[model samples]
Target: MKVQEIREIIKLVDQSNINEFVYENEGTKIKLKKTETVTVIQPTASPDVVQGNAAVEVKPAAPATPKAVEAAAPAAAVSERENLHKITSPMVGTFYQSPAPDSPAYVKAGDKVTADSIVCIVEAMKLFNEIEAEVSGEIVEVLIKEGQLVEYGQPLFLVKPE
Candidate 1:
């Protein structure tokens, strides 16, 4: 199965009342299960796995509840900050704020950046990938600290678009 298909499946399951869903095609198997706080997707075997094409675990920030619904009203204000663009890790890896440990960080909060500006590096399987801002903006926050393990598509920085 393709990654996009898997993503669609996840979206369907998340929105539905189903607790578990399993799919198999050829030699690949995909299993999705929803817990109180997380939705996990893993392969029964070694094919079409998400994380490095191996295994993947997706966690929701919080579970759905009445209290959470009430809290969401305040959270909606966060959308006011939606103008901030997120700089996300392209792959699962250790996030490095600098090219090297002794060097200064590529960018920090309040730093200005344009599309293609190298904001940080994600080291996966010994390969260092320089992450870019992809938007013209001022860095508003660094979501993750240096040398932290970041997952694919995880937000690393928030930028206030210029």
Candidate 2:
């Protein structure tokens, strides 16, 4: 789904009483859950009582500043450029560093790897895709954190070519 559509869905969810919702189209699926609860009470008592209740839960909405969003865009672009030689995700999914919860990671930040080294796993559609390095190099940085949902074409690591 488009990002704008997702944003609208989120807004609707924030203002409603729904707890959870899921939508799937083609091969993509999105699930959203309300992380906090908001309660509104009817005023059956005096006006002073309603005013006191209103003062109980007066939290301001926090919105992202335009300048902060703009700054993040360039930082993301620069990181992509720096990891141009590293292999990126072939599809969108949750990235995992190990095969299982108890297993060791396929590679570490400083590990040297070849074109065929399995650097990580990207889980999509209940399948674990073993991501490999496309070039021989030492891993300079791991761009994604464990259990993070990544987008297609997003950089997963940085490799200094050997």
Candidate 3:
């Protein structure tokens, strides 16, 4: 499904009372659920509250100027990382190194891969989705640990092209 269409569906669900919705087209499927939460603010109704308020007001204000942080030497790392290609997550999910927990990992650092290689699996909503390498290269780094929560578009691996 197109990104615009998915965004539109999300908009409709957000404005309505619907808590859960699912849409499927061809091989693509999307599911969304809204969570309701309650926030409670306590009212201060005692003399102690007023005393605490007074104490807070008596404290000096902080300086407006922000402290400058030391800049790291990033030229070499930046250029090297930029030259290497990346494989990123297609959706938000928990990353798995193998198809099954007991199985050996599909790929690792220094391993060579092709465009169609099944490098990893991402579990979203209890569904296991195999992720492809999409480019032929030698994997330079495995960016995520097994069972890590991966965000959409987050880099999963770095590759040095073959």
Candidate 4:
């Protein structure tokens, strides 16, 4: 299913009282579960009521000025990154930079990739999935390290699209 469809499903499940939901189509499977939280309130002794007609004055907080936020990096660098496309993981799994140990990485920074190019692998449930660079571009960055646990929709690489 599409990412938008998955987002919609998540929204529906979150808004409803359902605790768990699973969906599978073709070879793709998605499972979503909501964590339950329990809140406990303890009874406390009530404060003694004031028996005097004492006058009380309340002071309001002074108005504060908002500080100007400074940019962390140069504007050119930020603009360059904004033009890049991100290749993200399709499932929660371990990220592999290569098909196997001792093997050269599938792709790295400065490498050109097509939409069908296999850029990395994500192993989930013992199944090694070949992740493709869906956008034709020159890979500008590898966001995740090898053997790292990656979350679904997490960015793995940044590409300068052709």
In order, how many clashes per candidate? Answer: 0, 0, 0, 0
- Candidate 2 global lDDT: 0.72
lDDT of candidate 4 over 48-85, digit per residue (tens): 33335322222222333332233467878877887899
What TM-score against the true fold does each predicted structure earn? 0.58, 0.52, 0.57, 0.60
Clashing pairs in 4: none
Per-candidate Cα lDDT values, in order, are: 0.74, 0.72, 0.74, 0.76
In candidate 3 the C-alpha lDDT for residue 92 amounts to 61
Per TM-score, the best of the predicted structures is: 4
User: Which stretches of model 3 miss by more than 4 angstroms?
Assistant: 1-74
Give model 3's TM-score versus the native structure: 0.57
User: Residue 41 error for model 1, in Å?
Assistant: 16
TM-score of 1: 0.58
Error of model 3, residue 14, in angstroms: 16
Candidate 4: RMSD to truth: 14.6
Among all windows of 10 consecutive residues in model 2, the one with the lowest summed lDDT is: 48-57
lDDT of 2 by residue, 1-162 (tens): 665576677677657665455566677677655544445454454322134223222233334355445464687776655555757886667999999999998888889999999999998767788999989989888989999998655789988887
Model 3 Cα lDDT, one tens digit per residue, 18-76: 54555555666666555443232433532222342122111222333321222254667
Name the lDDT value of residue 25 in candidate 3.
54
